[model samples]
Target: MAGGEETRKSTDSLAQESSIIDTFAPEARFECPICLAWLRDPVVTACGHRFCRGCIYSWLEREHACPVDNMKLDVEKDIFPDNFTRREISQQKARCPYIVRGCIEELSPLDVESHMIICKFRPPELPENEKLRCQFVDVGCTDKFEDEPELQRHLESEVTKHLSLLSQAYTKITISNQASTSAIAQQANFWDPPAKNEQVSTSEADEGVNALLRAMYEKIVVLEQKSREQDIIISNMSEQINSLNLSMSKMQLRHCNGCYLWYINDFKNKIKDMQKDHHLMFYSPGFYTSANGYKLCVRLNLSPRDPNYIAILIHMMKTEHDNTLEWPFSGRLSITVIHPIESYRNIKETMMTRPELEAFKRPVQDLNPRGFGYTEFVLVEDLKIQEFMRNNTLVIKVQAQPV
Candidate 1:
């Protein structure tokens, strides 16, 4: 019984094959020599032979000859449609190409191409179950599975192993990228050509270095200008500071007590100005008394009323401390005039206050001048001949001793 069943199956298969073969006529009139299939859109050539329109046209392009007899043919003028043969072929039934895969459909020759498109057994599409591969295939994973779910299960089972591989891959990629970047940077910073002569390369390198130096020089110039501006600002500040110091020194001089030294510069110019004004006297600014409560100054006369002599005088002035001082001032006064010549003795004088002397009288009011001095303080000829005018300056020292 098993042998009989096998024989029957074989008979069915042979019948199906025979049925498919019969659809295309074995006769030469229906068969196209090009494709050996039943003629589609049959057309007759000038040589009295028929072929499918496309087959004849393609054949004519290469040789201008009829495919059957090698007869020379003109494609546009010799080919004519064999409408009767086309209609006969269209009515002939053909088995589907998928008949071996259990498709049982039969269609006319004209409808076969369209029917094959929708044929159920035309190698049914690979299901999702059989289309999966390992997710790491791009990273050298060669494993595959029957389905996506199976692949996912495999991945989960070997997750730790896969992760280690991924880490190694990532490290390699990172290192490669870093190396590539470094190579690019090296290429960018230098102009080393493999084929160029050493001398040429060196010359090019020198030019690049010179360009860099020029840029640096320009920056330095800008910095230098900024430095100069800062210097100017500092210089102005220094001048202001010096002017303030000078003002403070003058203030200190105005308030000093005891002995004070005075320097007279431009003595010749001062003397000339006084001479022009017919005023021979020049007074020093007020200095404090030794007691620090009274203000006094000195007067020097370059040309006194006596033509051959110079004169010196002393004066006292009212002050804010007047009300706190003892009345009827009594003090010893000493004065020295410095000669420019070091070897010469400085003119020195001292006097003790006396109530009877008008110059020593107590102040009745501010500027009630009762001053005292010598009419012939020094000889003018001695000043000119004795080197007493060095660098047009004169120095004088004065002291006051309160009794």
Candidate 2:
């Protein structure tokens, strides 16, 4: 009879403990689709279905999608519903699902979101500024920045404003220097005579006066020569300034896609007489065909912009066709003027391949295309003429040529 009573007492204690546990634990709405275990903390998808946090995360990892409907679950953007009220449930509660996997703690549904986001077990964020972050975060920038506003400022800073600031600063310094020079010249008393002028005897005066007169005459001659040189320099500079102004005022639209062609033309026409004809051309004529059958031909527009030796157009080519093309073989075509040609007669002969030749062709445009231009050019190598064509947009560089 005593052993029977002991057994009944033990059974009653076990039932009471079970009841306490049931009271403290949160009621689960669904099972984790992945682990087939009771859901600990549930997350709601944009599509309004609930799933275990771990199950949803695993699904996203496999193929960025919701478990039930395959809707895109941008893990970063998905909203995790709050379980703040679940924390108020009694202490005899069940442990979090993650507890068995070494996360030995319980978290309210509300706190689970914060924990999951910063969870070390979770995938490490790709060093921030990753395209996977927020929608506004995935810009074309390869470099990672700390925040959005900083990146925005960087993109907004265009080359034009940078150039303008530099130009303005240069102008400011030039004006300040000129002002200082004018002030010094105005302050100088050039006519002041020395006290020694009153102390000389008649003969000494005559000899000294004659010497002084000769010295003054020599000084006058030197000053006049210097003045003439200064005038010549000023005239040359003025003429250059006027020519530059004229060039700037004459805004032109060039059909030739070669950005450097006009510059080469200016070298040949305006500065040709100043160059030496004996110099050799650096780049020889060549042709290149893209994967899409767009052929490009390059040749010497052999000329210089000044009296010195330098090829005005480093690479110049014209294409034979226009329209859509893939990249590497696509994007904007540009000619990099490696050397500033100062004179027309200096030329250097060089050899190039077909693709290399095409890489430097001028862009072309379709007149119907809202913003573009067209160009046609030929390659002349070894006295042989080959035709090439392209229709790409022209982006004329209007900024002052850099020194």
Candidate 3:
């Protein structure tokens, strides 16, 4: 009775933690079980629960059970990308993070950051009432709309009109400043002190010149602001693209039907760099043994003891299937250095999972601290002479399966 009561309490606590719903979104379905937040890059488990890709991976590093129910899950087979849920969550309207500062704009996830970049309310000094002005009101343009989308459309459609206003201002400023060019050149702005001999600009004509200069300065400031916004948008887009590319590449490596190939590029540079950094190493993206099997990764580095040779190690990675799969996983893990045109020249080694070794046991962390494999996989000179490398690139294939 005591053990059963304890189990019930544990289950109830996990359920409560996982159910901390996000009130910001329209529905609770988008919340990640592990993160207690809106799921980004969501994935679904076989049990039909959704989680953020990163959150689930991090969670599985320590616990092999589902966050919601403590049910076992297989990282390889049970987990699938929840594209539908991701789309739904992204499309759901969300308020600006700066909404507390008077930004009344609500935007989809896709446009929120870009909108935030140019949000007039984002300026701390601007009053709530002042942020309601049109985007170009400072540039001699009329305030036409108060609606955010309507304001955007007006800005887009009225570019010519806005330009005309600027041109007219520039022309007027040019004519007015002609008489004061010498005076203006001597001083920077209305704020700047006059020359020792010159008087203060309180006269009507002098006031007119200062106003034109201020208008010109406003135009310059607006242009600079627009340029910086573009730069931020570009930087954000670049980061998103890089992240997408990285995720795609890792997925390709992680889910390649169990047979994984690692391409070591700039081989000569690696060798040279290895000399300076004796512990220099490269890790292959984590791969699975089967669709529902053990997750593993390979490590390659130059032998610290024998500089002429390379070292290779295979590490068991913690996965959601830890509870279901065999502990001290039994299998034959092999690594082969390929000689594409000459199959016989490939250097190969096969290691059996020793039951007594910690390297073969269920990983206690995201990656097992202990690794098993060859310390001297092959000689550098031998690989160079054996037609092992192609285009300064070396390829290795790793395969794991039950005996």
Candidate 4:
């Protein structure tokens, strides 16, 4: 009687401490046998047992057996539920069948679904098996995509990785075309002259002809343009050379002569006379006497009455040959008239003796002129002669001997 009474009290206390009615209060609820968590999508086995979705899913992974009675279970078999008894049982707390402890408070019907998914005490969510028979199970993919169709849809419509690939292919093609064109140009440059009898197909021959014509036309155009430009440059250079020659031909007078003269003829004979009389001092001391001397002197007879009284100028003018002229120095004629006082006195004596001769002779011959005059010329350097006038001239001036 004592043992029996003690058992009754213990059982009553156990029932009071954990009752489905008190834990769940007003709604249907249950704990999973495998995980000791609230039942979500609770399903019954063939043996009239129930468990949570995740708990059973995991248990089925390794061994298909019921946790409570070790009853053999078939996954393919549909779960048959007794809803009337489940509703009644849901109102009271039942002892957790799990080997581990479960939630202290019984779960409400609404919370049961969420509880099973994340319950720490619940068995691990099973790894899906993708064997031929398990078509619905997606093993390695964890994208929240349920099936192959969803994964395929995501890859094709959303990602469109192939479009990027096509763009890359087109870029590669463009680069290849440019490289091929460059290579062809380089090869053409490197090709040696071909043999006359090289055989070629009709199509290849036509293509080659077209290519050659195009290249030849381009080259011809370039050459023509270059030739035209070069011609213009040469013409301009020639004109400049001519102008420079003309400028270089200009000669400055050394005697401070205000006038300039250009001789159009050779004055070699007149020049020889001037040298013999020593009237023109420009000849280097021994130049006229040299064996090879071919010096030129020009003489122009001028009456003191002539509007241009340049006798002394002729004496003072410096001279140079065109071939020997240089920059800053020019071809000019210079004459130095030596008026010896003794000769003038003698002439005076003779004139005084012969009145007739003296009548024709100018008394000034015995006297010195009031002042002297000089001549100037324009000439060029020897180096620039070829560029100047093609022909040269010289002039000579001879003073009349005193009557």
Expressed as tens digits, the lDDT of each residue in 1-403 for candidate 4 is 4554445444433443344224333333356667665565677888877776667868987888887788777777835554654564466443222212233345545454456445554333223321111111111112334443454575566344545543433333221122212333422422311211232343333333344444555678999999999999999999999998765543222221322233433333433444455434232111111112112223343223431222322211223332342222112223322222222311100111122322222223322122122332221232123222223333222221111
The best candidate by lDDT is: 3
Cα-based lDDT for every prediction:
0.64, 0.38, 0.70, 0.38
Tens digit of lDDT per residue, candidate 3, span 77-195? 88999888877876788766454345668777646656856877542232222223343443455464433456678888888998886565445554344433333332223322222
Q: Report the C-alpha displacement of residue 150, candidate 2, in angstroms.
A: 98
TM-score of 2: 0.17
Model 1 residue runs over 4 Å out of place are 1-225, 236-244, 247-256, 340-344, 354-370
Candidate 4: regions farther than 4 A off: 1-199, 251-403
- Please provide, for model 2 over 1-403, each residue's C-alpha lDDT reduced to its tens digit, 9 standing for 90 to 100: 4554444444433443344233333344444556554454666778876666777777788888776777787888885753642233322334333331245456544344456445454322232212211111111122333444544565566445545543443333221122212221211211111111122233332332333334445578999999999999999999999998766533322222322332223323322343445244323222333333333322332333432322323232333443443322333443332223333322233223233343333345311111111111211221111111112111112111111
TM-score of each: 0.41, 0.17, 0.43, 0.22
In candidate 2, stretches whose alpha carbon ends up further than 4 angstroms from where it belongs are 1-403
Best by TM-score: 3
| TM-score-based ranking | 3, 1, 4, 2
Candidate 3 TM-score to native: 0.43
Query: Weakest 10 consecutive residues, lDDT, candidate 2?
Result: 386-395
